[model samples]
Target: LWRVCFRRKLRPRQVTGDTTYGTVENIVAVEDAGIQAFFPLPDFDRRTPFFGKGTFTYDPGADAYRCPQGQLLPRRKTKYTEEEVLYQADSTTCNTCPVKAECTKSDHGRMVHRSFYADYLDKVQGYHETEAYQKAMRKRKVWVEPLFAEAKEWHGLRRLRLRGLLNANIQGLLIAAGQNLKRLLAAGRRHAPCGSLLALLREPWRLSAVYG
Candidate 1:
């Protein structure tokens, strides 16, 4: 239910700002990955401006990982960040890997970085192939698709609002805030009682205030 992102210099150093999109297939390839599955992200690779993607994986055991080509990649190394341990794969194993040609050609090999507190993403993934996730996806069609239309037709958000990262971030937050408001209002209509509306409304502030 939270969104977090990071930037890392991509491969083929020759091409700056380029990135590889992550997919459910790639994520499920880890051994002991414990993840179930993921909701599919649209494959929008216009490749014109900042094309990137992220896939959520289901972690059943809350350990290990699998690759896209049905390769089972294991978590091999752990690096500590002041607050948590970051589990990464050993580059050597990735280098000598036959699947390396398809996964990542990075000098460091095909490794995934997971924080000590990232187990939630794994659990979410575990629900990926579930009947629950499938039903949720169906509901999402009725949930998200139309909201996007509202943003475009009502909020004039059909096109990019500004150029570069600064503007994009602002625009995304504005859209997200609007979406939260809509969801909250709809909840009231359903007589669902107050839920995470207030907390979600304050989440950005809370995360900024604490995570930093």
Candidate 2:
């Protein structure tokens, strides 16, 4: 989609999606293309009882995280498999701290993993607090989701019959075309005048003749 947009010289202001499309890679790619990505960040930390990752403040200049208790967690190691750098608090400091119980139960103290693309993720996350983001999300819910729902439920897109990537793309395009044609016909009917309806009913052969 971004390639097509670039080729056509279409400069979109923003892109919107659900959490499924909110990966760090996607956020970075869209933002690097100079478009705002309005999507919810997938926060798995929210399910934890301890202080969530959001509680930590990132200091880009220091390349460290400031904990809720004001302790700086310095970069410990990079987990290349996860594409993140781990920042960890000193275990001795955490063990003696007043907020240890609230922070973590791990013997190794509190740790926060910052994605290599965290800067972009931070920008995208900040967009969640904006009016434009809210408006875009609302529009996506009403304008975009229903088309996907219709395609999956009514257009046999729940599972693809084709075996290859190219075939699947073709099937999806055909389904979308069919969906668009349905909407176009419905719109035409709604806009047709009573006289036109009567004429079509009286001379059904005219419809066949015109279409043919």
Candidate 3:
């Protein structure tokens, strides 16, 4: 949808979502599609570490990460199954470090994993810590949640009655139309001649025809 919008010159300024859509993959995807996305960091990524990955800094020159213990964790191997590169500390260095026990249980010292696109993922995490990202996330929670609640509770859109893509889309549009008509009527009632508003509310079916 975003791509289609972009091609049609209807580019969206930004997209915001909650934690569920905050995966590294999704954030990278959103950014790749040329939209700024605001999402909280995923729980797995946000876990407090024994010695956090931040303790290991990357060196582009050597293409390796330097551990807190001053040991260089060079690229050990790449996993074919997962698009990740693993870097490991020398066993001798880890075995000799006074804080080895605090750092890693591995015989080969400590290992850190980096995604092929870890740079993009890290960029997303960086943006997540910004004040603007936080404000956008709060707005997302405030605006999107109520519509889902309203659809489920009042419009019976909690379960689908229709099958197939076409029918399901039609049902969704109809549900949205119903919700919009309700909002319009409520607004009208607030300002319309008093008795007429009551009459309109008493006969909401008339709204279906007008909305359609």
Q: Which digits, one per residue and each the tens of the lDDT, describe model 2 over residues 1-212?
A: 56667677778999888999887778888888888988898777779899999889999899999999899999999999999999999999999999889889988879999888877887787888999999998878777778788888998989999899888878888887787656556545876654545554564322211100
Q: Give lDDT tens digits, candidate 1, residues 1-212.
A: 01221232222211001013224334333213432334443344343232121332424475665554444445566766433333334677767777666556577745555555455434544655767667756655665556657777876678876899777767867876776666667656765456555555554432211110
Q: Identify the runs in model 3 with alpha carbons over 4 angstroms from their true place.
A: 3-9, 45-49, 153-164, 193-212
C-alpha TM-score for every candidate = 0.33, 0.82, 0.74
Candidate 2: segments with Cα more than 4 A from true spot: 6-8, 193-212
Q: Which prediction has more favorable lDDT, 1 or 2?
A: 2
**Residue-wise C-alpha lDDT for candidate 3, range 1-212, written one tens digit per residue:** 46557566777766777778877778777888888877666544247545777678998799899988778999999997798899998889888999887777778678898888888767777887788888887766666667767787988779989889777778778887887678667767777565656666686544432211
RMSDs, each prediction? Answer: 15.0, 7.0, 6.0
> What lDDT is obtained when candidate 2 is compared to the true structure?
0.81
lDDT of each: 0.48, 0.81, 0.75
TM-score pick, better of 1 and 3? 3
- Quick one: how many clashes does candidate 3 have? 0
